[model samples]
Target chain A: MVRIRNLRKSYGSYQALRGLTMEIPRGELFGFVGPNGAGKTTTMKIIAGLMRADSGEVVVADRMLSGKTGQIREMVGYVPDFFGVYDDLKVQEYLEFFASLYGMDGKEARRRTAELLEMLGMTQLRDEMVDGMSRGMKQKLCVARALVNTPELLILDEPASGMEPRYRRQLKELLQELCAEGMTILISSHNLNELAEMCTSIGVISKGRMVMQGDVPTLLRRQRETNPYVLQCLSFPEEAIQILKSDPHVKNIASSGTNISFPYDGTEEEAAELLTALVAKGAQIVSFYREEGSLEKMFLDMTTVP
Target chain B: MRHLNPVYKIGLKQSARTKKTVVLLLVYNLLLSGLGLVVFYLTFDRAGRVREDVAYSGILTLYSVMAAMEFVMILFIVPASTAGAVAGEREKQTLDILLSTKITPFHIVTGKLAASISMVILLVISSMPVLSVVFCIGGVTVSALFVFLLLLVVTAVYIGSFGIFFSVCCRKTTGATVCAYLAMIIVVILLPGLLFFFECLEAFGSVGYIGIRNVMNTISGKRTLFLLFNPVISFVSMLRDQVGRGISIMNSIGSEGGLFYFLSRHWFAASMVSQLVVSAIMIALSAHRLNPTRKGWKSGRSG
Candidate 1:
């Protein structure tokens, strides 16, 4: 639904985006992950037609981003990391106001407002003033506002920030449902586990570049190869450590109490052979399992700047 | 129409629903009534023997005082109101959301300008009863009253445009307000003052009077064009015409009678067109600043 090629932006001496490139297919929930200053928001802003890239090409919802932002804005729903609501404006009025901006007539705006309020479970708060609502409620209202245009591609920057777990879960489920219904969503959040659970595909950006991206399970399974295998010894932990030191595939082996962990770069047959030798050596192994990889771990491993 | 700008509605709704708007209306009308009463109270005879011409003069004076007060209120309040329009949206963090919509920048600029002017108009409409007090004695005409209202509205547009320009140029409302007022002080007060000083030097004390009309009549070269930008001079010129037959100050100075008479007779019309053009330029500049492709606002990074 969105494609960026070699996008670059600089603020004076500091470069924010450095030849970044990525793409999201139609009807996929793409998770955008990066550390601080990794240009995730900048990229999203460029795609949503909120900011101009210094040099690059971006096609969002099949339209090339150019001098005309109006068309792109119509096709894209953008929920920034930090946003505000008009005080003294009722929740329903606020939603309808945004809908009207998208060229919806009064009848269309009312229908859409009612539909969004129902979708957000904010029907009871329709008459309540926007500023009087809680922050989480306001955040949900912002999401509803973004969805008012029924955009083809939705870009949310840190949508789950400061959200309660229950509401966050609801937002996740809502996004998943939207994706299932053929809407393309590009979301950036610090909640890696939530993204992993909810996203159909994941793209990890580091230093303004797409370092890694693929389907969630496939990416994780590929990442799982680098994960360390940890062994727990009921006894003879020193013997297990000595065996690990002798093996070239087992590097940086760490032992604590009865547990020993190290990354293994061997095939399944070689791994089985090593385990058999360790078992026959009277290491008294109690448990040995490869640590599963997570989105959080993968994000840290990819974007942690020294 | 359904195509009315929603931001305008949002601005009007917020302004109307706030206690500040209510308090402003009450205090403004009270000040008008109280001051109108005071001008009459101090001017009228102590005993119950007021003359007709004196009463007529008092009503005219009352009309003049109230009109000047409203003009002054527009000069000050319009700037205060509009200087925060765009900057407030930026501070509230809603500007990005608004700009990211399908609404054009022209809509944002014009919608905000309309809302600001609407607040001033609301004040003027609400105070009509107090102004209507002039009709009790019979001196001021309804057409004159409307001219005053039009002048006030034009002046609001004149001042509000600068306020919005500054609002878009500055990051904070405080900065925008300060800059707007500074710009107004220069245009309304200093521009005329400097031009008059130069006119005084050129006249070399030959003129009998040292007033604006005299200086305007005596002003020479392209310097007279600068006074067209002064809103205060425009209103004062318009006021001088309505009240005093405007004196023969325009035709009395040398053979260059044509330009002076035209300006002296139609200062209001000339200045209205001139100021509106300037205001349009300011609005266009502001819209440019809010342009999405412009490298204006600081872009925040996600990393």
Candidate 2:
């Protein structure tokens, strides 16, 4: 649904986005992961038509992002990392206001406002002043406001930032439900575990460059080839480690109590063969399992590239 | 086009709730009528005599009051209203969310400007009782009052334009507020003071009065040209001409046959055309400022 090519932006001497290129497929929940100052916000802003890119092409919904900014704005719902609400405006009024901006009339705006507030669990706060609501409630309200126009693509920058755990779970559920409804979402969050659980696809950015982007399982699988997996033994852990280290496919080994971990580059057959050889050597098998690969681990491995 | 655009409804609600706005309107109406009542009572006994001096001095004083009132109101209101328009949005961090919507920049600019001017007009209308008191004395016709109201609207439009412009340009509320105030000071007090000083020099035979008169004329003409750019000045000018029978000092000096007499004869017609042109320009300029995504004037479209 979204494609960016050679997207570059600079703030004087500081380059925020450096020829970053990536594409997000339609109806997929894309997770954007990056450390501080990684051009995540810059990229999102360009897509939202809120800021200009120095040079690049962004195509969304078959229209050039920059040239057809108005159309693009109509197609996308954006929730910024930090946001504020009109103090005296009620929750319903706030939602209705944004709905109207998208050309929704009074009756239509009221209908959409009611639907979004209910969906986001903000119906109780409909008549409450915006300032009187809690931080989590306000964030949910912002999300509802963004959804007022029923945008096909939602670009949310840290939508779960200040929410309590329960509300955060509610936001996750709402996002999952939206994704299930075939709405594309590009979400950025520091909470990698949540992102890993929620996102079907993920992109890792570092220093304005897309270090990696693809399906979550594929990325995890690729990174796992180089990841160290631990093998635990009830006894003779050192003997098990020594046996694995001697194998050519096993590059290195580290031990913790009765657990021994090593970087394995062999196929599943070879790994199974090595385990059989260890059993033949009389090493007691307490636990035999490969380490679970997650987006958080892959993110740490890629972005921590010093 | 959305009948219930959040920005529009919220803007109107906020205006209604603002204590400062409510108090300003009340005080403005009470003061105008109170002072106007006293003027009427004093001149009630000499209603016929007031018309005799409908000459240069009478027009000049009226112009002064008109200018002063609008300038002062702008000085007070623009800072309070527009200083917070964009800057507050940024501080709230809601600008990004608002910009993300289909509402064009022009729409946002205009919506804010309309909200502010609505409050200003409310304040101006509240003083109508005082204006009605002027009718107790003769020579101030209803047509004249209509012209005066037109002038006020024009001047308000002009002043309100600058407020929006500055609000858009400045990143911080304090910066916008200070810049707006400074600009007003230059337009209302400083520019006139400089012109009058030069005129005084001409009076002392150091330079020709015509030279000083030309400077004032240029200023007045420029002011008229940018009338919509600053409505406070136009409103004051119109008020002086309609209620007080005074010509702007600059116009008086610049035009031949004593500029005041010239304006006194064609007050309504001249102001109507001049202000309309100025208001159009101001509105267009404001629209331009609001559309930041557009590199410059070209074949660009607004959402």
**Residue A2 lDDT in candidate 1:** 86
Report the lDDT of model 1 for residue A133: 90
For model 2, what is the C-alpha lDDT against the true structure? 0.72
Q: State which candidate has the highest DockQ.
A: 1
Question: Best by TM-score, which number?
Answer: 1
Query: Considering every candidate listed, which one attains the maximal lDDT?
Result: 1
Q: What TM-score do all the candidates reach, one by one?
A: 0.93, 0.87
**Tens digit per residue, CA lDDT, model 2, A1-306:** 999999987776788888999999999999999988899988888888877777898898878866447888998999988766787788888888888888888888899998987798778889998889889988888888888888899999998997999999998999999999999999999999899888999999998999999998888888767777677787775565577768999876777888888888888899899999898778887776678777777888888957
**Which digits, one per residue and each the tens of the lDDT, describe model 1 over residues B81-182?**
999999998899998899889998878988998898999999999999999988887778888888888888888998999999998878899999999999
Poorly placed runs, candidate 1 (over 4 Å): A235-253, A276-284, B42-55, B205-217, B245-249, B252-255, B258-260, B295-303
Query: DockQ for each of the predicted structures, in order?
Result: 0.62, 0.40
